[model samples]
Target: MNNNLQLYNTLSRSKEKFEPLNPPNVGMYVCGPTVYGDAHLGHARPAITFDIVFRYLMHLDYKVRYVRNITDVGHLENDADEGEDKIAKKARLEELEPMEVVKHFTDRYHKNMDQLNVLHPSIEPTASGHIIEQIELIKSILDNGYAYESEGSVYFDVKKYSNDYDYGKLSGRKLDDLLENTRTLTGQQEKKNSYDFALWKKTDPKHLMHWPSPWSEGYPGWHLECSAMGAKYLGETFDIHGGGMDLLFPHHESEIAQSNACRGHDPVHYWMHNNMITIDGQKMGKSLNNFITLDEFFSGKHKALDKAYSPMTIRFFILQAHYRSTVDFSNEALHAAEKGMQKLFNTVELIDKLTPSSNSSVDVQHFKDSLYAAMDDDFNTPIAIAQLFELSKIVNQVNDGKETLTASDILFIQNLYSVFVFEILGLISENIKGNDDQLVDQLMGAILSLRQDAKQNKDWATADKIRDELGKINIKVKDTKEGAVWNIE
Candidate 1:
């Protein structure tokens, strides 16, 4: 289980060699959705990005406990301390209970993730479910003299914490700059400093979500839930903490302050953040009103989409770019990704049918080495995918009888595709459903056999009719020396 993985640490602002706190056992925590609305393309980016991280760590023979939390209770509208709770607002708009709203959106999120082929996390804690832990954490911060209670609300004292620690070390923000730039929003007057953020807020009488605490009958702050839930599951310290780059500011920065203020040290060893998705060179977000939900992309119901994109096509499109790079979505790019995904799937099928010879022509070992090397370099999926494309070319040549492969080489190719494509990259054939694949194959085989019989009997009209009908259904049939091979176009 030799693994030399390098990952970019947003904390240190550089790529560093990955060293887990405990060898063979790693813990990772990622910030999850608030469950107030359907997941969009922006949401898919970090989900798939950290999913690769989780899959690759397991591939390296590490026992990983991955925790991604649901922000069901504390998240507020506009990410402000005084705004309406996002889930509560949505519940009001939909005329449902807050819990009902949470359950509905959470289920939809899971379904979208399932369609995208993302594995479920080892633990999915919800903010509402962990109120006691969050209250305890806030108490600890107050005990440590880094937080204060004012008018039944508790706020983390950014100025007091900064005097004893580098408050903005993770985000490279200075205390003075934060104070100067902090917005003077309504209900912030109670804080000792403008830069101070809430750990727990005293709820309004009409507030839907409230928990009993010594300081107030209110919900935990947005940032406190992750800090409490992560430390509760992964301990006071852990290996990796990942989320979207947009969270690097107040959300994650405040997490750093709250955790360190309680534990007297950083909670995570490595900090990873996936970049945002862009549309027409601008960030696509709900606030921007240009955001497209995952369902909308799948259904092609949005004006921006030219056609419905398969889940695998959306997954491939995201992986085609490096995780840290801004991925711009477009119809042309998605079409190319759909075509490329089909080519890879077709090559894998072709590889299984290629007969082995006494010798090999391609450097299978070199290809394997390059593929792993690309993955090792900060999970450079785009580079690894490029090498897979190269291997696909070799597989195609062998299938065309233009090249030869030994039995061992053929096995190597199959295993490599299984590991890199199916296991690590988490790509599944969109056209092939479980059990349906075998049935489809059996049906296609029967149809193709009927066509072969017609051709053998020189019944040209019947054979032509069968071929034309399959073509109309986007199934291409190719005639070869071995007979006719059918594939979905």
Candidate 2:
């Protein structure tokens, strides 16, 4: 196995060679969804990004225990710790139990991930289920004198924690700047500083979600869940902590403070963050009222979609860009990705039919080296994909009798695609839109057979009508020497 993988660390702001804290055994924790709404394109980015990390790490012969948390409780409406809990609000509006809402959306989230071919994490712990763990974590922070109880609510003392340790080192923020720019919101008089975040909130009688803690009959704060659950599953110091770059602020920043105050050191060795997906140069999020859910993209229900995009096309579109770079959503980009993905798969299918010669014209060893080299350099998938396209050209040449490949070289290319495209990239052949679907292919074959019969019988009207009617529904039919072919336009 080639073990020269390097990944970008958000803490140090550099691409560092990945060396696991414990050899052959790696622990990774990622912050999962809040589960109040549908899984959108924005959510897909981190899930697919960390999934590639998870897949590639295991491919290198490492035992990885990946834990992704489900935030079923304690996430409030704002980062300022004001307003009602997000899940509770959803439950109240729908006239359903809080857990009911959590279960419904969580199931949908799992379905979306399955369609995208993302693997489930080894341990998926939920915040509501781990109340005892979160409470115990708060007790440790309080005992360390970094938190204080105020009117039945416990808030982390950011100003006090700043005195002993750097409060904003992970986010590169200063306490002075935070204090100066902080707004004094309503119901914040209980805290010593406006920047101080809630560890445990004293829920009102009307609040939907509440638990009994030593400080108050309330729930844990939004940021406390990951710190508690991560330590429980992956130990106090884990190998990697992954999430979106949008969490680099108060959420992840507070996690650093809580871990340092309690355990007296950092909890994670490497902090990884994936960039956001955007629309019209703006971040596509539910808060912005601009996010297109995965269902909308798959079903073509959104006003922004030109046509329904398959799960594989969405995956390919995302992989075409580096995880650290912004991917802007556009119809043209998606259409091109769909075509490109089809071409790659078509070339792979053609490789199996090539006649092997005595000697190879293509440099198969150099091509294999290029594939590993792209993945080694921070998992640069776009570069790896480009290399595959170059090989696709070679595959086409071999099929066209312009280039030659020995039997061993043909086997090597087939294995390369199997590992890189199917295993590491997590693309499913059955989900690749058109020709890969057996049912659709069978139906199109029957329809084209009827059209060809009409043409052969000298019935010009029937043949032209069959072709014209299919075009009305965005399915184009073409006449070639091999008879008739139809495709989704």
For all candidates in order, the CA lDDT equals 0.90, 0.90
Best by lDDT: 1
Model 2 clash tally, residue pairs: 0
Each model's backbone clash number: 0, 0
Angstrom error at residue 417, model 2: 0.5
Where does model 2 exceed 4 Å of error? 79-82, 431-489
lDDT of 1: 0.90
lDDT of 1 by residue, 242-316 (tens): 999999988888888888999899899999999999999989898787899999999999998999998889999
Error of 2 at 14 (Å): 0.4
Least well predicted 10-residue stretch by lDDT in candidate 1: 430-439
